[model samples]
Target: MAQVLKRFFDLIVSSGAILLLCLPLFLIALAVRLESSGPALYWSKRVGRRGRIFLMPKFRSMRTDTPVVATHLLEDPDRYLTRLGRQLRRSSLDELPQLYSVLVGDMSLVGPRPALFNQRDLIELRRENGVDQLRPGITGWAQINGRDELPIGEKVAFDVEYLRRRSFTFDLKILFLTAWRVITAHGVSH
Candidate 1:
């Protein structure tokens, strides 16, 4: 019953958001392309619910030659960032494309952020903690809590907590906090 309601909410909210943000999305994509050599969107293989692999798109924020790994893993990650990358990432404008993932039902508007397919440690922890049962999200409890600043174990802990306490109200709280966090660029290390 709750899952049904949540899905309905996700659909309605995501649809409206997409419709309202279409022009901004297109302009952001154009800016990404104008600043970088690669395509405007970077499609990443992310681990979704039940360990499924899905392509999650983001505005391309890094150089064409950047390694296909978590940004934290890169040696001197800043060097690989495109000219506009830092601002895009800090403002989280790069993540705007993921609204499509929510619209298509590949993700929720709130839950655990999807892990990169190669993040075996995080994936394993999530699976062991039953976090994999929940759909991946565009923004999540962990995202609002600490985002890039949290260690993997701590992030997974927050994910598990969210799994245990998930509800429409909780989702709304997370969404509110995420907006605040993005506005302040809090907990964003890069």
Candidate 2:
């Protein structure tokens, strides 16, 4: 019942956000293109529900030559950052394009965030805990608790908890917390 409600809410809210934020999205895309000599959007292979692969889009925050890997795993990831990349990341502007993912059912408004396709350990742990059955989210329990800073094990633990405790209220709280965290740029490293 809650899953159905959550999906419905995700569709409605994501649609509204897309309609309202179209101008901002266009402006951000222009900014990204003007700052770097590459496409404004970066399409990444992300692990989705049940370990499926999906292309997730974000503003091109890193240089064109950046290796396809987790930002945390990069050798001096900051060295690959494009102009205004840090500000985009801190303000969460780079993630605005993912609204299309949520609208298309590739993601939810709240759940465990999708892992990079190469994040085998996290994928296996999530599969073991039945978290893979749920749709990934733009912001989630793990995200609000500790986004880039959480260890894989601890992040999976939070994801498992979310799997068990998920509800409309819980998702609403996560969304609220995500907004606050983004505003404060809390727990975002690199």
Candidate 3:
């Protein structure tokens, strides 16, 4: 029942957000293309529900030629981050494009964030804990709790907890907290 309502809300809200952000999205796309010699959007394989592979879209925040690795593990990630990338990432604007993922049913407005393709250990742990049953989200409990600063194990724990206690009200609370975190520029360890 709540899942149905949540999905409906996600559809409505994400659609409206996409409309409102269209201009900014266009400007960001232009900036990304101008700043680097690659596509404006970066698509990467992510682990989704039932161990499926899905292409997750984000605004290009790093050099197009860089090796694929966990964001935190990047060698001098700041070096590869483009000029606009810094602001987009810090302001959480880089994730606005992911609303399309929600509209397409590949993601949710609230859930555990999608894990990278190479995060084998985290994937295995999530599968063991049945966390893989939930769809990936744009912002979530783990995101608001510690974001990139949290270890994989802790992230899984928060994810599992969210799975167990998910509710529309809970999701709204998470969303609100995420906004606060972004506004205050906290937990943006990336």
Best by TM-score: 2
Candidate 2, 117-190: lDDT as tens digits: 99999999999999999999999999989898899999999999999999899999999999999989898887
Query: Which lDDT value does model 3 have at 85?
Result: 89
Which sections of candidate 3 miss by over 4 Å?
Answer: none
Candidate 2 — which pairs collide? Answer: none
lDDT score, candidate 3, position 187: 87
lDDT of 1 by residue, 43-153 (tens): 999999999999999998899898899999998988998878889998999998898898888899999999999999999999999999999999999988888878999
Instruction: Candidate 2: list runs displaced more than 4 Å.
Output: none
Instruction: State candidate 1's TM-score.
Output: 0.97
Using Cα atoms with residue i matched to residue i, what is each candidate's TM-score against the true structure? 0.97, 0.98, 0.97
Q: What is the lDDT of residue 46 in candidate 2?
A: 94
Off by over 4 Å in 1: none
Candidate 1 lDDT for residue 57? 90
